[model samples]
Target chain A: MRYTRLSRKKRSIFGSVQLWLGDDHLLVVRSMRFTEEYRRFHLRDIQAITATEQPQLIWMEVALFAISALAFLMMLEVEAIAARIFFGVVGAALASTAVYDLVRGQRCRCRLLTEVSSEVLDPITRVSDFDRLTTQLEPAIAAVQGVLTVDAASMPVFAQPAPGTPPLRQEDRVETPAGKYIPLLLYFAILANAIAYAAGLLGRFNEGFGAAASFWFTEVILCVLLAFQPRRFGLKGPMLGFFYVTAALIAIDGIVTIALIVDLMQRIAEAGRSGTKTPTIWNIEWMMTAGKIAIAGRSLLGVVGLLALWLGRDRVVPASEEVPPSQPQP
Target chain B: MTGDLRCDSCQGGIPPELWNQQQGALCPYCGKRSWTRVFPAIQHTVAGQSPEAIGSESESSCFFHPRSRAIVACDSCGRFICGLCDLDTGSTGGHICPTCFTSPKAPGSGTLLDKRRVLYDSILLGLNLGGFFFFFWPSLITAPLSIVLAIWYWRKPRSIVPRYTTFRFVLVIVLGLLQTAIWIALFWSVANSPGRGSRGPAL
Candidate 1:
């Protein structure tokens, strides 16, 4: 077997990429190191070649987030109205930053490794672009690799099933069952909170109530999406996003929980001074106990779901990699 | 920005349909053409090349396949192997034969060749935590063992991923003394008791 250098005229050293075309494999060597490490991607082992453009993470956004987190520490005393308002603004800023990430975070990631592990070649940043390099190399890969992707959009029919028949094939149903959807329990808990939120809306619907209702409604929608669309949750960047978003939402829920506790304690103190039990639902000890139990259960479910998401982050393999054995290599 | 295409000018997220243009993607937000390169997916044939069989009777034959030509000898066991049987785990070439590589307990097996140092500190911390629950009795053996291990492996190598070790070492020592004190207290109470002589009445 002979090795030849791939056409390097069009290729630029934008993001530390050096590729060589071999007889039966692709020799990829990452740059910016004294001792070069070359990973040989065999044509037979390569399932698919996929690329994604993501924005580079900045230190400024991280610093801003740290400031937002520190704002929460200023509110030890409930009487500090100024500190409370400052915290509210910081929380809003952090939420806005999450939205900011969804927009501008795009760096080009080229996955040249096999299916088992993500042995990435190089991630191209703005300072270094690999568009022309990939354009030159794609043809070389296709010449040896063969066709890898099946575009669903190009196919007309997905096979509409007859009445009372199972539509999905057994192997195609590798998507986890409802029991494996740990986030569903969290979604149910959020829905319960949203229902109570809507019920409580009728008595007093002020500007603050409107804001709280909207936040809870947003949380309910996010949880529902996370619960039902388990397959989409496995997508690389979005999976990590789901984890962080869930954490942020849980933190907000905790702040609301603390406020409720403070209100309950105030009601109890008022009743003690009067030497009689308050008749209102808000002051009822049994109702308070039930609320505490529900909050504890919801928080417990959220923590469990977060742990599961972290542990099972790399569990889902790409669908393209699951090629059938019938089409054996010649 | 292939997955979540966005207009750099306005910093607004652009939908896939709006950005799917050959000439250049025109961002609807800022009305600027976001000219970027995008590549389609590639697939390959999953086949391996087979080694040639030996024809000459005088040539050295493979250990596994007697008819095949022997290309290299195993680094660990010195067994002759054909081109396909030479599994090189190391880059600098001491091409190990498949027999030594696949053998579970063999010295050259890939399992024992770890580059990153394992975290024994965490394991020691776990033992101390468990001993605390069992009320310092298990700590008598575990505390000293952990302390000894920590000091012994201190100069061996640090973790590939860095972590604090000073706190762990201090905690292990503190618990070791605490465990020793509990054992001493039990002995002191028995010796100072008024009915110490009749403590073992049944015996």
Candidate 2:
């Protein structure tokens, strides 16, 4: 039987391949460069042989991706009404499953290929005529090479590996840097909830639609960003951007929430002083005050979001270093 | 031999049936002996080196000659640097080591410190705003103080520091505005509510 072994160099550009012709004899091939032309193997020269199945992760990945898409679509209707509640549930589930599937797939691929390859191949040799055929084919198998290229400028400058170190192998994996987006999403959620609650309290829920729309729109955009590429705007980058935009919106929204809260408080205060039930939202006095507070709260969150972004400036990796490695696990 | 045979790879003792599994005696460490070769164990030692007391070793070594020891560690690379490689900056105390403390690569201390400080400032701003909402007017002082501190911090030579200082300043301003709005809303509600012939009808 023939066995072909391929091993990559730690620093050199090209990989090494060794072909064992039989129990005692072997053939060694070396090349300064790798080329597709070397991959062909002639089956006519082979007497008999067993084949090794290459490890693949297509099925598991497809299943998880399908599941995540399904979960996203399921929440679409509810998202139109109360997006925070709807997306919160959907996001939590999809993120969790995606994370789980990614981790499991990585472990399975690494272990089965590196540790169990020899054991699985051992049984294939038992077939008659397989050994002789494989021996002749071994040389061709050794020529195959794996190539990976990395853009160094995209990664954090602090963690850049010394030149000549192999580009990180795990770069192809998907990483969700949801930290920055979560806070921005949370800010919008809280602002929306606050506005809704205050508007309801003041009996002006209908008029509160503007603030609601703003809050919901911002929330949706943030959720979409998170779902699509969490790592691209990870850590502090998206948070700062979200805060600036949301802060502006909050500045507008806060006016409404604050107006309502104050009007309610004043009505209660006045009733205490003069001893009379406050007239409802219809009254110009109460309505106007509620309007002011609503606008204020809207404006407040917006500004607060901005401020959060500013104070969190260090959080945003500089643009030069903004492009994170394609994949950063954990 | 009279003893039981073993495989080197698996570390399992071999049975009589598999005694001649390959050409040679099995390794006791791992049971499998096929495709394995015996080699003498080698010990690595640094020649002409003497063991020194643990704390006595110098922190820095010469830049051109890494082995020549010096007292100070390079502020940048954390390498032991000797006198020839040490570049002295008077106020900062230790001389910067040439290898690790190159000017282009080394980040300024102020930049790192400012980033850390901004995080603290954000927390303070948030808390102060909360206080203002809860009717503690004195807590609003942080708003103005934060603005001043931010401006002062940012005014320094532009380094990585201003990014965080600006962030903190923005946070304080946002908090301040929110607190002011809350107060305004309170005033508006009190002013507009119906009264008992004092201002208007009680609502």
The candidate that achieves the highest DockQ relative to the unseen native structure: 1
In model 1 chain A, the worst 10-residue window by lDDT is: A321-330
Segments in model 2 whose C-alpha atoms lie over 4 Å from true places: A1-96, A99-330, B1-121, B128-168, B188-203
lDDT of 1 by residue, A1-330 (tens): 244554232234432445665555666654322123355655545543333433345455444434443443333223578877877677557745743442323344544435343444553332123454455555665665553344434322221212233223224434222123334434444545544443443343233233333445335434544444444434335554655566465666657656765776788788889987854544456655555565565455555655656566444324542322111011
Give lDDT tens digits, candidate 1, residues B1-203: 11322344444443333322333343333333344332232122223435569989898888998888988888768888887787755432257776676564456443322222345555667776677678757776776776677677566443322236566666776776676677678789988988867756695
DockQ of candidate 1 is: 0.02
Report the C-alpha lDDT of model 2 over A296-323, residue by residue, as the tens digit: 6655764576467446533322233222
For model 2, residues B70-163, the per-residue Cα lDDT tens digits are: 6566654666555556655322324565543434336542122121112345445555666666668764565555445545545543322122
lDDT of 2 at B30: 29
How does candidate 1 fare on TM-score?
A: 0.35
